[model samples]
Target: MRVLKQVLAVAAAGLVGSRAVAAVQDDPWLTLLLGTATAVAALLAYQWVVRRTERRDVTELARAGAGTRIVRGTLVGFAMFAAVIVTIALLGGYHVHGLGSVTGVVGLFGFMAAAAVTEELLFRGLLFRLVEERLGTWLSLLVTGVLFGLIHLANPDASVWGATAITIEAGFMLAACYAATRTLWVPIGLHFGWNFAAGGIFSVVVSGNGESKGLLDATMSGPTLLSGGDFGPEASLYTVLAGLALTVVFLGLAHRRGRIVPRRRPVDAPAADVTVS
Candidate 1:
């Protein structure tokens, strides 16, 4: 019931935010700013709802309630995506060109900021966390991750392989990020970094959402598997491998930290010992 309430809160916040962004579409800056404000507001509402319904600490809903760790996770996400784009450029699969408009960059940042926060809250904060309690870590990861990627099918120029790649790569990788730290901040940061880099920095087609100008104009070429074809670099084989590598790293860290949620067994809970008064 708590989970359900949280989901409703997130949805309501998102709906209001989307409408607000739409109203300000004429002004990119305002739109981005509004989007961000609404996203944060939504998350706060989600936390409030969870606390009210479940009487849970709610700090975990806010990423372990640690500002430092939240910042660290965000930076790590940016770095991970940066690594992928950098590797692609080094391989000659991506060629960078002239600088883009400052407005474009800022707008992308705003849009990405909103997206990263809201999506992470919905998928990782709500879905994965609740699901994990019932289904265990690995299965919840699979379910939520696939749902994450599958949802992207709505993006323009999306393809089967692209969706599949997202499922295997981003879906698992982002979930793993949460599992590692038992928080959503890192995954949100990672999501923002990946999207911003794809659409705003490298000037690639982001999940086939058409080309949005970034800091640079990049001409992407090479095989469909390597270049990700019409869908963009995210659909590339390299992207999947990179995501897989991170998933492995984060999962290992989580396991070592004793944070990985184990599968529930059919056996009943052991009875508490009763002592004579």
Candidate 2:
């Protein structure tokens, strides 16, 4: 029953967000506000359902709040993506063109911020956490990660390889962040920062979804394997490698902290109450 609620909650969130975004596609700022609003509403719904159905305290999760962990996580995400950009630059795959406009900057930032929060709330806070309760850690991670990647196929220039890249890089790493910090805020921050830096700051294509411009006016050139083609630098092998490295670090930290959920075995029912009927 709890599992059913979780599924319903996630589906409801997707509907709310998709519909809201569609309604305000013309105004980037509106899209941003509505996007965030949708995420918050979805979160409340999730907590309400979980608390009512499972009888668990939702206080701790809320009390965790968006604090220093969020800041640090955002910075870490930026740094990792920076490393990818730098690698591509060194390889002569990227070039600086000029500066971007104010409107462009804010648009991308708001869009990405909304996207980050929405995705983290749905994927980590709901799906991964709920699934872990039954499927355990590794299996939950794999399932959520694949779904995350598959969903990205809806992006503008998405491809099989791009989806695969997103699955392995983002899906697992973000889940690991939740495991390590035991909160959704960190992963939300991480997602926001990565997207903002890539799309808003660096003026690059993000996840093949679309492009955004900011301070740096740059363009990607060279092989798709390195440049990530139309799917953007996110498809670059560098991103995959960096994401995997982060996943290892976060997962190791979570394991050391004893946060990884162990697989549970089913207990046999009292051998069917034995014979005398």
Which candidate number has the best lDDT?
Answer: 2
RMSD of 2: 4.5
* Candidate 2 steric clashes: 0
TM-score of 2: 0.88
Prediction-by-prediction clash tally: 1, 0
Worst 10 residues of 1 by lDDT: 59-68
Stretches of candidate 1 exceeding 4 Å from the true structure: 22-26, 61-66, 266-277
For residues 203-230, could you state the per-residue lDDT of candidate 2 as single tens digits? 8999886666677888899998899999
Please give the lDDT score at residue 132 for candidate 2: 90
- Give residue 3's lDDT in candidate 2 (0 to 100): 72
lDDT string, candidate 1, 83-201, tens digits: 87788778888887888656777777777777777888888889998899888999999999999889989887989899999988888988988998777666776787788777777
